[model samples]
Target: MDSQKRLARTAGMYYLIVAVLGAFAHIVRAQVYVPGDAAASADNVVAKASLVNHSFVADLVQATFLVFVVMTLYRLLHHAGKNVARAMVIFVVIAVAIICLNMIHQLGALLVATDPAYAAAFGVQGSEALVLLLLDLQHFGYLVAQIFFGLWLFPLGLLAIRSGMFPRLLARLLMVASAGYLLDVLLQFLTPELADAVNPVLVTLFSVAEGSMLFYLLIRGVRTLRPAEQAVLAA
Candidate 1:
């Protein structure tokens, strides 16, 4: 019971983290980022839309994001055992892979931005080829990460819902949240034109998924603690 409470507390902390990060991103987007883009050139637009500065905010937020993902999946992989930690380490591996991919793409974009020869060739006049390239990489990278996060959470949501470890409603909420994320991503892919428009509804619904799950964790987490069951499975 105590263990469950502790986990719930941690889950609450994660909610705070996500909420704070999202809020701060919104503030910056409103004041500085969007205004700067309006004045930027069309050629520079793609690069600006590449999400260079936006990516940095996301980078900071995601630094510890994987930790929560790993924590939630740990119980599932080990079923609660001494090896739970081992299972969680797989997430760490995923994080490293993502970081590596981002680094490589960022570097490639950098080369594009700085190489005046390449810039001239592409007819990229306003935005540095390197800057736009990097932004492009960052934008795509963000989308990829979102896909992974949604899919990753899907199973976790199912697990909690099916385990009968918490209230049925909690599970339902998770399922709904998962669906929202999936839908949001699919919508983004369908509308290539709106990809950079930053529509308010899209952003709003996209975040509901996270908020729903966080609510469940903070509220019903006490009922979901299954360390003994987890230990048996881990064995």
Candidate 2:
């Protein structure tokens, strides 16, 4: 395969890995997590320990794959705009760091939910409460990461626009998705009631936005530029 084709396949594989594992983890989490019900959430975790373990493992592996996705995307786009590519890497790296660090909270919650010692120390009720608290930390920390998640998209979208290898609509949609992400996080933090009402719509839009680009990369690879365009990209 040529460089573009090789890079596309690598990125496509990583994207697939991240998406599949991420969806799996999220589905498991949603199945077990009872919003605003600490006792119920804890009970669910304890009852479905194996499933929760799967979720955690999937999340960790997905995150690891995402590092490759970012690196590959950087290599693909850096020729179009170096500074923008660097910004994209920086934002994604920050987001990844936050995500990896936040997993400890999830792990802590799991330990508290499963260990008899924790119950002995804090009592069953207190232990459950602690588990809930830790889980909440993980959730909110995810929101914090979303800030960088949105930031990375801006530069990525800009690069896509300049590269002339992607559809202009794709670039526009990415920027729109970035706004959606920032808006979702802001409302979720500042006006949670409103966020609850509207977040699903925003999430769907964001998914579609990213999904479009993902499918394009997988199916089309990067467009082969003409000599003039290549010169511009190199410059």
Candidate 3:
């Protein structure tokens, strides 16, 4: 139980780091990216180059720490169901890989916006257009990664429920949040207009679910298992 508490706290700390950095990166992107306005987007990127760079670095760091978050979680939760825990880890790993690769598009956008060579080669308007295209690709790539992000939560929620460590309500909320993420991605790709309309609701759902889990882990950790529960887990 002591060890479990330690693991839970560690996972919470790592998750907090990932969440904060990820939010910062997203906020920066939202602030700088102007949809359908390539010239304006390029100008924003150039004007906020330092912030953009910092956001890029934040993303990389978030991705790196996400692995730590999941590995610790796997350790803490694997006793519930090894296969489920493994699935969760695999999903996070895939998401991390996709995120790292997606950053190349971000880097390309930055380079195109700031590098004089790109203007010389493609002209200013062309360079700006290329920047927009790369940013668009980066946006889509993030959605691709989000698919796995949502998937991992299913296994995690199941494990939490089975383990009897977390509140069942919280576990269910995580599963619902997982579905919400998938729905958000689908709507964004399939019916973008509707996606924009409901995005706030989806974001709120995610915040409530993930925030609850994080705070619980940080503040409450896992419940101590009874002897029978321990035996069952051993079995």
lDDT of 3 by residue, 1-235 (tens): 8989999999999999999999999999998788899999999999999999999999999999999999999999997889999999999999999999999998999999999999999999999999999999999999999999999999999999999899999999999999999999999999999999999999999999999999899988898878997788778
TM-score of structure candidate 1: 0.60
TM-score of 2: 0.95
Model 2: lDDT equals 0.87
Per-prediction TM-score: 0.60, 0.95, 0.97
What's the true lDDT of residue 10 in model 3? 93
Tens digits of lDDT, candidate 1, 1-235:
5665566657656656756764654443333222224223233334544454564456456546556645644543334333434533553546435654664554454455545666677666543534544545655564565555555555555555544455656556555655665566666678855654644655565466556556656765546447786565346
After the best TM-score superposition of candidate 1, give how far the Cα of residue 181 lies from its true spot, in angstroms: 3.0
Q: Which stretches of candidate 1 lie over 4 Å from their true place?
A: 22-58, 76-96, 103-127, 193-202, 224-235
Give the whole-model CA lDDT for all candidates, comma-separated: 0.52, 0.87, 0.94
- The candidates, ranked best first by lDDT, are 3, 2, 1
Clashes of 1: 5
- Residue by residue across 144-169, what tens digits does model 2's lDDT show? 99999888888888988998878889
Q: Which ten residues in a row have the lowest lDDT in candidate 3?
A: 225-234
Model 2 clash pairs are none
- Top-down TM-score ranking: 3, 2, 1
